[model samples]
Target: MGEVEIRPPRPEEYAVAGEVTVLAYQADGHLADGVGYDATLRDVARRVEAAEVLVAVDRAGDVVGTVTIVQPGSEYAEISRPGELEFRMLAVAPSARGRGIGDALVGAVFDRARALGLRRVVLSSLDRMHSAHRLYERLGFARLAERDWRPFPHVMLIAYQIDV
Candidate 1:
């Protein structure tokens, strides 16, 4: 991998970008084989229409990571308030992990929030995603325990936030 470009994916790359997101989640054990949520994760087209979807493409233009930025009223936003931006479905290909791709993706989220003049950025993560929690903390996000909630049975999501 040479330089990575973080930007909205080209329309032709939607399927591949969606597949990369699903692969990353499955590889990380955050998503199970044959789960219905896989469909949601792979629906990049829907996300593109409802929010800002960004991809981290390698020098060869292959998408290795992706994330969705959701405004307050979007269907994907779990806990964003007025004057805040929320991001969801952050994923980086397993082969591309440990290369600062995740950091870059989250950084891009902050950039988006700032560019939009939002006062903060928020996100939710599963408890099992310890590594992701570390990344968020390293990026100055604080735990928002009060905002934690379970979106589904047997699955609890924790919240984190950072003021821009």
Candidate 2:
């Protein structure tokens, strides 16, 4: 880990959303399942004004990871608890995977979550990604439930929640 700095996403950093989305979710042949990375990036852009986004920048100031913190609303109606914050999109570039960039991005969320006095943080992750599941567990997130989700062929939708 070479000085990973996690900070709030700025207006200019929005330009990296699409590229990051593609790297985070796309290029995985098994998980493609007809989902559109472009649409996800657009949603991220649209929610930027209301959502809390954290980006991981290396010592050189290049973004290597990102995590979006979404609050409850009609936008996040799936979340039953209004006081909960969702760790929606968490991603670390392939090259930065083992360097603690993901941990830094997630830590930024926890820092903000504590300041806001949030009750819990929730997230949905695909079950196929076992390593990611381990990472979330290592961060103290426990499995809440698993269900079938939309936009993909995967039937296992593991949801996790962590109390603040």
Candidate 3:
């Protein structure tokens, strides 16, 4: 209901951003308690240090969503290749859904890629994340079926890429 700003999280806001990420993932059934992936999603400080962590804040200056953008060769990079940028761990607060915060955060990644003269933006998502898949499609991301991977048994990660 108010203006939203997309920017890097301040040091003091890391904890809040991590909490928002955890809550958003849990509320969406994207995470389970006591899972190793849950801890990864809750580690905003680590991501901020290893990659670019962006947060969306409302007029009240509360973090409503967040995403982590990783460059090629970065420690957190999973799907990006040379000449491409990758992002992961996109989360929008449950209460903040449908407000375009997710789109704004993603757009920020595209902006960054363009500024860096990258050819494309890439990411990986779980198969069950249909909502996120739709958003990616709407933003011109194409399925990279050959690049789909499975990090753990029975857990497939679908890949997508968009030319920027």
Cα TM-score per model: 0.95, 0.84, 0.95
Q: Name the regions of candidate 1 deviating beyond 4 angstroms.
A: 33-35
lDDT of 2 by residue, 1-164 (tens): 35787877667777675467557665443236565545665355665766777778788878778877877773643453677778776877676678877777777777777888887887877767677788889999888875235445544567888888
What local lDDT score does residue 111 receive in model 3, on the 0 to 100 scale?
95
Model 1 quality (TM-score): 0.95
Give the residue spans of candidate 3 off by over 4 A. none
- Pick the winner on TM-score between candidates 2 and 3: 3
Every candidate's lDDT: 0.90, 0.71, 0.90
Instruction: Report the poorest 10 consecutive residues by lDDT, candidate 2.
Output: 146-155
Shift in Å, residue 22, candidate 2: 1.7
Question: Model 1, range 1-164, lDDT digits (tens) per residue?
Answer: 24688999998989999999889888878875334888988899999988999999998778999999999988888998899999999999988889899989998998999999999999999889898999999999999999999877778899999998
Estimate candidate 1's alpha-carbon lDDT, on a 0 to 1 scale. Answer: 0.90
Itemize residue pairs with steric clashes in candidate 2: none
